[model samples]
Target: MSIKLPDSVPLHRGLIREFHDIRVSDVSSSFVSCQKEIYDTLMFFLESGIDYEDLCPLVKSNCDTYIQLLEQEEESQGFQTKFKTIKENYKEMTESCEVFDLDTMDRYAERDITAPQLSKLLKEANDGYIPKIKISITMVDRILRAFPYIWKDPKCILPDSLLGDGFNNDANEDEIEMAGGSIELTCPITTLIYEEPMISKKCQHTFDKSGLTEYLKNSDTNRYMEKDCAKDGCSKKISMDDFSPDTIMSLRCKIYQIKRNENNNNMKLEALDVL
Candidate 1:
């Protein structure tokens, strides 16, 4: 299942922008608020099953904007610099909220530590703070409840044994042989063709269907289509291979590998703009 969101929406981009807007445009010195927002956003993303690669661009942009703002705050005497302090408070909050079960603890001890009583005693040592014993345990419970999804694998196979090695069965022998070989092949594919989207001028053809078909037919290229063309309005059999390198069509190719709206049967797309 995949989530369907508009490519134009830039979901993460907007969220990050909102965070920045709050700092400069709204409340100026509330570090805790900012920290909470950040935490909430992180939690939202974590729960949404967004991969790190997709989230990185927005995060990188956010960090760049944040660092500049923080630097400015540091220079201003009146501005209360609270980013670090707030971040630490957030860390502390998350740490205190850790949850654990007695059964789970015992299981961990049996599997890894071998000294269950000693491990329990060590955990107990951090109990006697000024806020008292109960508060720590409460926080631990909160942490556990809030972060149950953490460290969960979105896709993984269960091991047969309690402890077993992961294996990849899909790897081929040539891959293994090449890895072991000392000889290096650095040259790129000599006859490599750029991913040039060919549009036909005639029949208002956007992709080179017939041209590719004809090229393949001639070359006996059974697997891959061999020809593509981009002529504005000509009916002639124009081949992409014949087109000048610089004249390659700039038609955009968007691949929607992830879709967010799988569950919402009622929801409908109002528009799917194609040029």
Candidate 2:
């Protein structure tokens, strides 16, 4: 069942802009605060009449980093490339629905992996005294969470969503039934309803486990050669190890089976009533 979100592009574009605004402007602003903190630390040391000559390098180093950042914003090719590449990625997310999925969610989380990289940058700007950056990818996180309805096969509930006005909440399980969007029960390879389905990790296509394994074994390949996936139109090189039991698909099949049985019983009772 698909729900078309009316006018989703503007909201999505806004979210992307907000994310980059945090990444670029907020982080850039934090650099100034960071520099002040460094100076304040040095001032604290000097007022105590302590020998802080070794720490003077940190001030110059921090200033250099701040200036380098300004220069990058002005004309650095390296910075331009980085900015362009990330902007292109965001552009795709705003304009295309093809990339939203579990794998991309994993990647989004990986992008904000830790404070270590920021700490390392601060250390590079100094001589390893700083251990933090007062920044997080909060806007990016919000953008990713805001578009659950856009996912091709949504696997989890988003913590939050945007465009509450655009969503038709009635586009639910009952909508799927009313639209005759029956769940696929049969395996493409075996033409049999699933008993235990195994899915290809790379392509997300499912097939009958034993039938797929046997077909792959008999394909045009030897011991060293990996067989192309048996699923029609898919060319992903695959082996038995590449397939795994899909619990969610299995659960869907079970639900389909139960619903089908109930429907058949209702038809039988109606036939008896007609007599």
Candidate 3:
């Protein structure tokens, strides 16, 4: 008796064909499994949410592997091609990313709008004058308040940090207050306001205008008045003839007349001593 076998059992020439089909099917299944594993691994590293610097090398390696796998599967039909296409699309999307731009100032330069190229741009901008600047209401109000006290330079723009402090490139807000004697003397850049100028009397010793005037009037000696500015640019000479009686009296009285009237004796004695 020949060996008996079920219909499912391979026999003679058909057996080899059956074995070849089984082998091909198993190889195809294993290739699908390998491709799925590689895809999953690449996706895990890509989506790891790590810093770009740390992930860059891993991403490059994964991409190289993916490209190689795609080349290998060029003859294959269906799923592999679809996955490779998805990855290529993803690479295109990711590699096109960009960073946002920010505005910053270079303090070393005197002007924000600088020489040559920048000057040309500014000229062009001013010619058209679109006024593209954006500012908040609070900033406008603050600048408006400063406008009366602060003098602006023709070519300079003041930063917000410099405002509240005195802004002439010298002295802080507190020093300005001290010099003005607790008042902020706001004035246009070109004008001079009255702070007493130093004067020397005919006696030849120097005193401030107020000190000299008080000495002249209260003292019985009747010394003459003279104005002198020690500075190189100014050579103004003051005399009693050039000034009014009230100006003379104001210069002589250390206290304003209103204050002197209330405490006349002390100021009168001080005024008398210069004689």
* Cα lDDT of model 1 by residue, 37-106, tens digit: 5445544654465654575565455444444443443443222233333334433443343233453354
Q: lDDT tens string, model 3, 154-224? A: 11233444243322324222222222233222111212322353323322222344544553443565666
After TM-score superposition, what is the CA distance of residue 93 in candidate 3 from its true location, in Å? 53
TM-score of 2: 0.34
TM-score of every prediction relative to native:
0.19, 0.34, 0.20
Across 47-135, the per-residue lDDT of candidate 2 in tens digits comes to 44322234345434544554454344333333434454455554554454424345444443444221123323324534423223222
Model 2 spans > 4 angstroms off: 1-183, 219-225
Question: Cα lDDT of all candidates, in order?
Answer: 0.32, 0.47, 0.36
Question: Model 1, 103: alpha-carbon shift in Å?
Answer: 89
Superposed model 1: Cα runs more than 4 Å off: 1-28, 78-275
Worst 10 residues of 3 by lDDT: 99-108
